[model samples]
Target: MTTPADRGRRGKDARKRVPRSSHAVWVPPVDRPDAVAVLERQGRDRLTELLPIRYGRMSASPFAFLRGAAAVMAADLASQPHTGLTVQLCGDAHLLNFGLYASPERALLFDLNDFDETFPGPFEWDVKRLAASVVVAARENGHSPAKARRAAQETVAAYRATMRRLARLGELAVWYQRIDAERLLPLVRSDADRRRAEATLTRARRRTSLQALGRLTEVVDGRRRIIHDPPLVEPAGASDAAALRKIFSDYRSTLSEERRLLLDRYRFVDAARKVVGVGSVGLRCFLVLLTGRDADDPLFLQIKEARTSVLEEHLPHGPYVHPGHRVVAGQRLLQAAGDIFLGWMSGPQGRAYYWRQLRDMKGSADVAGMNPGALWSYARLCGTALARAHARSGDRIAIAAYLGSADTFERAVTEYALAYADQTTTDHATLTAAIAAGVVPASPDV
Candidate 1:
């Protein structure tokens, strides 16, 4: 049997792509359920369909380009080197995707922030996406192409070193020891970096379930309710509310006996329709407020609508598991420590999506204005983290063997990222043209 380590030792050929079996599961097109079609459609409906994909509409000119370029980039990325080592990918693990959050013990934790489009697929796919993100971010920040290339090269280089280092570590050591905020201090480079790091730690320390409950829960005329704001969210309708009461019964079956028993103490006070995320905009998401003893003690849960992974069609299907279940589990596997309330369940509409605390001290790194060195450093961290994630799931030894020396993979990916960055530019132009022609509604904010 070729263990991952043994494969790593064999040198490169073993890691080469083997013939793959056909996809096992059938995922619907992005156009499924009518809502996603707008995004899938281009030209006539291109800009309009592009709205949900863009977050914070006016945050930056480049973000609009990024959103518009997804379909374009996905088509391009579908054409890269694939390491059949499938695990839940962050789908978009850019520098911005990493953030500070609280562990169950309330310690500050920094890890991957986004997971939509997460599914089993090629490991290189993630590195490619992240590298492109850096490029896009660089372009937005007015960095020259040479600077962007430097950032990408450094990131890929770091990824190679990190994977090689982890490959040598005791398996248990690699698995158990995480770079938590508390322990990650040794990695900081400067006083300025340390200030931001310490600030994140301070914020993470203040986060708790109590904070999630405080921000999301409220009492409405003596009935506990999860607050709602229009377009963004609204209270669940009477009919759906009734259905959730029944579904809650079934949902209980999915939890552990103890968790079900613990939940039994709380009454499902109120539920509301909520909208969330950029790529996931318009997908069904909801907030459910559960109270224990009285309205004062509360738990806030966002029951997001999960859909088939965007990667499912592009790559072979992974092990059989509920999409929502796959997300929560994959996330746990990738992150050192995930949100304590990180759990999965099906909802009233029968639509699938994962849910978790909305805030929990969530804050990501600032990518714009970063010097070439900082960008390189940041890329290294992202690549290293991504490598660790892959190693945890599949045979890293085989991967290391295949990767051989970091030089080839790094060079190949840099070339690929550079070419793809050009493609992204074209797609952005396509979107901009569409917006001008009324093909899509381009918001100015993001």
Candidate 2:
């Protein structure tokens, strides 16, 4: 067994291969793949009709482009030198990806919520993506470049500090670490910010399945039926519904025995094909409504298609071969507490899909409208949450030692973030140009 001292030495030794100071550099390779081409490749296997919506959403802003261009960023990061410290990355850890969600115990916790592109890779990749997002968001919000750099710096500092703190704790203590939503109020300085935070939490609590039932379903012919919103949300056809029912049991088998018993109590009522997220717009996604006890008690489960991680081609293969299983396993390992219904199963045509509650008190911050102070605070919180997640799956002791007490890594990452934000801006423009030139179809109204 490696001792703590040995672990510390290992982290320190990594600096020789990739010095912490080297992280600040960001010069895109001359032969970097065209951003639109990368996005088009991702759309090939997706629902072709929905591809327009994806391009339209991503073309809205530079940050939106970054959100949808994980493939582009993944390739860029792979070309750079890294610390070689591996962790199960939240592969697309942009600002909006960190959010508030309920634990199995019903407590509200804030953590990394998206895992579609999650895979094992150098830990710094997640950090760089997150920092770059902060800069891009800050710029879009009209903050000065200096302010953007500061926000990104605070983010990395919080991550480094949190990692070091977690390294000093016992294994179980580190595993149990989490940021509770109630604690967020005290972290805010002004009453206005505190009230806003409280309101956000309250709003999230109201986003339960029962709320969704009222908002997304209506009584027709004495039965609760999912409301159709056209291309965004439409009822599944007879054949699609039949396929869902067939695979329901296989998905249930992936759950724990107790959870399976609990799931058995609910009767499947309806299914719908729903478009979701910027990057996931074209992917096959479905919403399953189940009723427990009575019609008023509703449970909405989302079955989303899972593709190989954007980082998969850049790094070594991970343990799980099945894409759905990979997403489910990564979520379980990285989350402080996971959903009871988290599961995976092969769909028709051997497509991979993962299942989870559609909404259980989940909410994300509106980064676009946030002031500089608010953005910095939120960015730091995201950084802390990310460190806690990484500590659970990677060598915290080594990472902490590598980061040290100095702010060198933070400063370097801030510099890289600003540079990468420029790249994202350029990439966003490229996509917009493609849409303008009729090279890509986009539906901005959607």
Candidate 3:
């Protein structure tokens, strides 16, 4: 077994191959794939009718474009030299991807919520994506470039600091680390921010299956059923519903015996085809409503199709062959606490799908209009949460050694973030221009 000193030396050795200072460099290669073409390729297997919604959502703003363009960014990152310090990356670790969710113990925790693109890769890839997101989000909030750079730097600094701190701890101690929602309020700098944080937490706690039942279902002819919102939330057709019911047992089989027993308590009520996120817009996603004891007690499960990670194409093959299993395994490995219902199974047409609670007190920060100070605080929190997650799956001692005490990595990542933010803006323009020229079909702001 390698000692701590050996791991530290290994990390230091990586620097000679890819210096920390090299992270700041960003010049899109002349033969870089067209951003629009990449999006087109990703959408090929997705629901064709929903492709317009994806394009429309992505065209809303530069940040929105970045949110939906993980494939594009993955390719860009792969082009650059990296530290080669591998971790199970939150492959699309943008600002909004980190949020609050209820752990099995019923405590709310802030962690990475999206795993559609999760895969093992260089740790710096996740950090760079996160830093670039901070810059884009800050710019969208109308902050000065200096403030944006500061926010990005703070993100990397917090990550480096947190990783170093975790590295010194025993294995079990590091494994138990998490950012509770209660701990978030102390980090706020102002009364208003405190109130906002409190409000966010309160809102998250109320976002339970019961709340979803009221909002997403209605009594139709004295029977509770999922409400129809057309295109976005429509009743699954007979064939789709049959497929879901047939695969329900298969999904349950993937869970532990206790979890399966708990799931068996709820009777599947109804299901609907739903449109989810910007990048995941066209993917096959369904909301399954189930009732426990009686109609009043409810449970909501999301069955989302899992595809090959964008990072997978750039990096070597990971351990899992089943994409859904890969997502579930990655989430379990990285999260300090995970949902009890987390599982995966093959679906109709041999597509891979994962199952999890639809809304277990889940909430995301409304980052749209945050002021500079607020954004910086949020960015730092995300950074810390990210570091905690990486420490769980990666070599914390090695990563900490690679980062060192100096802010060289932070500064380099900040510089790269600013440059990539510019690239994101250009790509956003390219997408919107394609929409205007009728080169790609885009439904208007649905």
Candidate 2 weakest ten by summed lDDT: 183-192
Please provide, for model 1 over 1-446, each residue's C-alpha lDDT reduced to its tens digit, 9 standing for 90 to 100.
76655565544543434321111111233533321233444223212333533523422355545543344445445644455655457666656777677766766666777666577766767777777777777767777889988778777777777777777777887787455666445556777776765675776666644676677666678765666766566788998788667766655665667767877898877888765555555566667777788756667766765556656667777774677877777787888777656667676546555667666766656667565655666677777778877778756666665565637777667766666666556555554566667655555532
Scanning candidate 1 in windows of ten residues, the lowest lDDT window is 19-28
Superior candidate under lDDT, 2 versus 3: 3
TM-score of each: 0.83, 0.99, 0.99
Candidate 2 C-alpha lDDT tens digits along 1-446: 99999999999999999999999999999999999999999889999999999999999999999999999999999999888888889999999999999999999999999999999999999999999999999999999978998999999999999999999999999999989988777767777887788888999999999999999999889988889998999998899999999999999999999999999999999999999999999989999999999998899999999999999999998999999999999998889999999999999999999999999999988788788888899999999999999999999999999999999999999999999999999999999999999999999968
lDDT of 3 by residue, 173-206 (tens): 9999999988788878888888898999999999
Q: Cα deviation of 401 in candidate 2 (Å)?
A: 1.0
Report clash pairs, candidate 3.
none
TM-score of 3: 0.99
lDDT value, residue 71 of candidate 2: 97
Cand. 2 Cα-lDDT: 0.94
Give the whole-model CA lDDT for all candidates, comma-separated: 0.63, 0.94, 0.95
Best by lDDT: 3
